[model samples]
Target: MNKVSKELKTGVLLVNLGTPDSPSVPDVRKYLREFLWDERVLDIPAVPRWLLVNAIIAPFRSPKSAKVYRELWTENGSPLKIYGLANERDLQTKLGDQYIVKLAMRYQNPSIQSKLDEFQTSGIKDLIVIPLFPHYASASTGSVYQKVMEIVSKWLVIPEIKIVNNFYDYPKFIAGFAANARKHMENFDYEHFLFSYHGIPERQITKGDCHNVCKFGTCCDNITEKNQHCYRAQCFETTRLLVKELGLKEGTYTTSFQSRLGKTPWIKPYSDDVIKEFGKKGIKSVLAFSPAFVSDCLETTIEVGDEYKELFEEYGGEKWDLVESLNDSENWVNLLEELVLENSHQK
Candidate 1:
């Protein structure tokens, strides 16, 4: 590291998708409006998006979504937010006093703009931004990058910024997940495994693929220059890395997409279908991994762990389990520290 780089104060900003402040219908409605209203998420004209979000989805879905959130919430608060705060504190300790660390949510309280305000006032000359999703997607990581850039563009004295958009295949990250899975493996000898990542629309995949190679088959078996930024390809790549690290056999495991919304042709091989197939095929035991997320939130905890478990069991499948997310683990903290130091020196 150069002397000048060492002297300038650097700020580390960690961000995640925001959650509803509470499980109440009004709170969930507010969160859904902000989340679905994002152009990148809904991908429609302003009028259609506004009408769909305000007039239809939020009003109709908010109450039911609020019910699910009620099941997922705990005494402390939202697990995603809880873990984000924990990661901020641990990463700060890991990096020591030389760097400043702050946590932000892309939508709700402690927003990206507000956190950047603190960095701007602190006279930081360099900043490192790490979005908490492992796999890169336009709705998640890309939205975060766009939000940060849009906010920072207005600052009078913008800092040099380095963004770690995604770390799907980072060594420590891969190991942390493998370790968690191993802990589950110690007790149960599961017969089949599912690597279920969050689903995005098909257009998002094609949008990132410049070479028109995202046929969603062997095209994602290996990452290439064309499919490098493709969300589907990256999800597959993350599964491949986890399989290699965990020594999971080819036929014994399946990579599928979950949390599909609106039924607009998301990536192929949906997770619920795969689970049913496993049950019909007489696979008695199963283990599920959600490597796309770093923290346990509504998607991982309730969606994957709770709802999917019920679906799997309804088909006569037995012993379904979801390997917990990294979620403020020591290795996860170490991974963030490494990302900050490594990127801080580069930009």
Candidate 2:
């Protein structure tokens, strides 16, 4: 009797937005140029966009942003990369010995192409690509898919691939986020819980409008099939789930967007404005959460943690606490593991 050969296996790819290789001006410039110039990111004509990015933004902003990133950088390097590696390790552990788990940055080093090559070379038959963005956006999750497909399309042998666009409303994800919030809040006194997400240019939002439903407030206030893929709507949904899970009242918590670039109108209830509002309202203690990002990066670490903290204090608020990100937390790891396993079985 001929022996049947065992199949190689399935794998999971966890992709994050990414960070610069180092917290230096040149590195930040290089990273920003690639990130900002993407048609999906900028969503503008080439000449005006080129003039804006190359002539104006990168030259001036790179130096300032690099300083912020330097503060966020650890001895090991970028916190985003460090946490991403940890997530991959913990996820592999939870998924058991049967699955091959890998992590890749959507933008910088250890890129999607190189990691996908590793999977391809390892003879993976079924692949699941999970972009770490909790909410779907063309600039974030969709960009990852584009890069993944760009690489896989070139391979002589392409594996069956599955992409999870968003888990903003997933029960496991909601539970994990709430649990983390509760864990942190247990030890502190927070008068308010703020969900601060990364911002994308408003033009990007309107262009990728799977439905013409995102008017910023009226549309995202009510999530439905029409605006299901809408970035603004999904972010609101994430906040809603967490608020429900944590039993937070309407006035007790709020959501906002951060890290907007070029100033052309990104999502609103901007973090800066929110911080000022909190301070002005005499809300002394605040706990901020970055739901858009699963792993902490410069946006969450420096932008939210440092910049917003200072802003809050400057505006008269006392004791602003930015909740630590879900960086390989046991519950979060298990949540991701289950997500992968359940999706893998579906294939």
Candidate 3:
């Protein structure tokens, strides 16, 4: 059989959690209005979710978030958007002419709907989506997948679409993270390391437990068919892989969750609390890693780098450093190319 023409084009859409177009309160409010309204995010009845977001969360939270975002913003705009665009450009170049690469924000400008429209007109025969999140969570990767399908379902002639649900265990992905963290450790002789991931509500987790096996205990200690898709399990497994690769002592490194919202319980051993405890225990310096995000954004840049560092220092701890994310780096772009090529070859 003759090989498919290089011009037959496979479309690649790289999606990220998104950012406000600007750091102003109004822009931040607009961004939060769209992000928190998603059922996958807040995960409540429509009426209550609307009230919580519009009446309370957006009104109160946006101003504070906007300030932090302003600190993270650059001349080019949001770090998330900037890195995302760079990755798109580099991946397109690396993948060569046969592939059409586009980047989309899950909640803001350059939306999935618009990108899918572009792909439809381009006459592509196949589409591959890689959500920038390393782990699979209902609020992140799952929501992106749901949104993309919603947009494409109406098309009369849909392309062969494949979505990458999770790449937490991908060697290159893990290596990229380890490489970033090592760079930081090499500069500072930190006493401890923390792998802090974005937190999700516990209820959201139980809903994904098909076999009713997620008790938030040893059940998640090992990944299995029962909880293969469990968010917490994947997080633990990711930490484990990184721990081994970095040769971290068993007790010296810990896994914690960050960026929690609301009064309701989230994943336990919260990152803030962990840091505070380390402070009280007189642990001086520590290196923090946010593996949940592939790009440098508000969470890793401000939340972990600034807010948490201050909190730790207030409690008498000395240095707290946040390892930079894998945004647009050569290693990360190479991983994206490999991911696209591997997914495209799958039957």
lDDT of 1: 0.89
Pairs that clash in candidate 1:
none
Task: State each model's CA lDDT, in order.
Answer: 0.89, 0.83, 0.90
The positional error of residue 272 in candidate 1, measured at the CA in angstroms, is 0.8
> What TM-score quantifies how close candidate 1 is to the native fold?
0.97
lDDT of 2: 0.83
Model 1 per-residue lDDT at 237: 86
The reply for model 2, stretches above 4 Å from the true place, is 1-5
lDDT of 3 at 346: 28
TM-score against truth, every candidate: 0.97, 0.93, 0.97
Instruction: Please provide, for model 3 over 238-346, each residue's C-alpha lDDT reduced to its tens digit, 9 standing for 90 to 100.
Output: 9999999999987888899998888888987799999889977889988989999999888888889998999989989888888889998888999998889988942
Error of 1 at 88 (Å): 0.3
Per-residue lDDT over 237-318 for candidate 1, one digit per residue giving the tens place of the 0 to 100 score: 8888889998987799999999888968889799999988987899888899998889998889998998999999999887
> Judged by lDDT, which candidate is best?
3
Per-candidate alpha-carbon RMSD to the true structure: 1.6, 2.3, 1.5
